[model samples]
Target: MRFIFAFLAMGLLTIASCEDDGGDSVISLNEGAVPNILKVTGSNTFIDLIALESGEETTINFTVDKGQGNIASMDVVLFYKTGTTVYRTVLESNLTTFPKAYSLTQFDIIEAFTELNSAADFQVGDVLSVSADITLTNGSKLNILNNDATPNFGQDIANSAVYKVFQNYIVSCPSDLGGTYDFVSINIGEPGGFVVPGPETGTVTFTDNGGGVYAISDGSFGGWEALYGPPGASGVTLIDICNTLSFGGSDDYGDTYTISNVTTSGSNLSFSWSNTYGEYGSTTLTRTDGTDWPDLTN
Candidate 1:
């Protein structure tokens, strides 16, 4: 019931079970003790999500114990939202043991989208919610949503009990943009130095500046807009919060260029970029594979 990481990821949450004494096997008004979400040692309370690369899997561990009652089972579920309504789907369910772990793979997420039933494809813009519930043998349910009297020792569920959102990343391609490359213009016939040939081997750096932000490597646009160039070329581009590769900046010549439509092939990167005061050209950068990258900051 709290917001932590904002995306699907390769990490898991571990749950530990409580001892069952088999005393009072009924839900009472005075039932006080609740299960707790174990925090990682010396880390913040936030849970890291899984980005789910190809052939990736992560196991989530949790436990459910009825202190004075007989243990029933625990259900860890996943939910996705559509418009204003939310749909509930079970990721894992019915665990009646201590220190239980449920592992999910990329195939699991794909199955969540289209499996025995035809759910919509999990795209880059979709959000899913994951939560767990413990049903006691006495027919009572307990989860993060059910508020305790003092709101005592528990997980960081946000105000008013809302499930955390999991962002689905269908494509990142961020790493593909980093490498040594040779840039050439697709269409000549324009000025702004869209003709020069030297400097064919420039470096492009991709750094994850935390929170989906990154610093793109320096370059000159056909020797036009230089990020790090000769004589007072002091303009750097920051890939904004949306994690898009689109950005516009002015060169030392005071000329501006809008960069967009960035894509990559097998060691070849191409994008349709244009100078505002000059001409539009499709620039291609053929990257030299396995080039040593500068130390990056996450």
Candidate 2:
């Protein structure tokens, strides 16, 4: 991709050289000037707004190069999305340095939005995109992004593996479901005295494995442990992807399970699970942390 951009730049220089008639039709650019390419360096590309405190932030680092001395300064432009509308503001201006670094806190974004008269609060799933607005020494402006806020460069160059001029960060709400809860379960699929009777009450713990995945202490929530043989169910896990719950792993007998019919009321959550071995259980987990349970659904 770098080679392709270089080739295109060389072609542009050739056209510019031919147009320089040495009289009244001379371009202000140098004889061998090439287009600039914004190269990204080390950086964190996501803004976990949920985890950020009052002074926390995310950062972006990059450099402007390949301009062949024609580049003068650049401006950092920020674009944030809310609902169906995209609003933009000039983040920083007259940046004449190479390998520049900038950090943006949630307050910074909110302040920019306030400048645009936006009263909406930034939320999860919103995207914050950034780009460069370059100015040449000849007093000419060069911007690969069009007026419609879309990249005017070639698709290959925009998706280039060697260079990145634009960066987009998503506001993420990391899932953390690590806690202890009191649960009540009743066996339905395999009735009778083989399973725990009378809507058994017990304690279950959920261990967070990061990124929305969790290791559940009991897969059956005490429905299959006490009566369904010695080697009780284990290795059970659950995934809470964007408030949607799903089951993973199998029991001790290699019977995979499925979770469905998840419902929540205030801070309480309930769900039904069944394994392949004709064992089904309905359980309700009550939160003790006083915080409302996540609005999860299956």
Candidate 3:
């Protein structure tokens, strides 16, 4: 009985040793296993990625995950073209700590692109590339090479690890409103108010008066003399917390007027104008400068 029992135990041990779980859940070193990239988060296309200042940083957010095992590491790479071959260098690399989230900021992408080894004389319209490559501890390359994922940004596919060939057009002082403009139209109505003579050509200039108060020059107002210099009730452009340019001025009729609903549409500046006498008007103006932007073109 003891010999039979020993033989059965030996047989059971041999069978157990031969059984393999296929390494489906965890990576097997001898099998040359690879990890699957479950998802990736990154900007695939840089549209209107404006840089207010040359050295100011633009923070980029990213997250990477794997379907099985542990995510070993991640890389945030900024790349540029050098002829037919594109050279890629890692800008950021790190080991995963639990959540596996990554963040990178380009202090000066415009300047960075200019310093590329094989970079050409590319302008604002030229394209560049950025990628976030992930690596698993199993020595597998989990990249955005596959187009089978979702399209995250600009032409990037889902679960893609790459933001390819993006061109950034840096807008210089986009919110500056100092230029000669044409009077598109004006409508003023209030209690017992007459049609004010709206100027056909008007010039608006913005002056930095310190403390977020702008000294405005309105060439269309008839009371050009009394429009300013009254302290709190003077001609001024106050930039509210919302960055809206609000014009406060007085006309020849001693009527306090303010343009509050200001907006810029391409080459036109339009706004809703109102007065203390309950008069309201919609006024639109177009830049007179031969270029689309009078103040910026020069």
Clashing pairs in 3: 149-158, 150-157, 150-158, 151-158
Models 1 onward score TM values of 0.32, 0.43, 0.30
In model 1, pairs of residues that clash are 7-167, 8-50, 9-49, 9-50, 9-51, 10-50, 14-61, 15-61, 15-62, 15-63
Best-to-worst order by lDDT is 2, 3, 1
TM-score preference between candidates 1 and 2, better one: 2
Model 3 per-residue lDDT tens digits across residues 42-85: 33222122442343444434443433334577555555443444
lDDT of each: 0.41, 0.64, 0.41
Residue-pair clashes, model 3: 4
Worst 10 residues of 2 by lDDT: 24-33
Residue 94 local lDDT, model 1: 87
Model 3's alpha-carbon lDDT is 0.41
Predicted candidate 2 versus true structure: per-residue lDDT over 76-155, tens digit per residue? 77778755678887778887876565666566677766543322365655667777677778886666454445665533
* lDDT digits (tens) for residues 54-164 of candidate 1: 333433233233333344766655555444445566666786665444444445655764332322233332344444556767786665332211122223232112222
Task: Name the top TM-score candidate.
Answer: 2
Give residue 198's lDDT in candidate 2 (0 to 100).
49
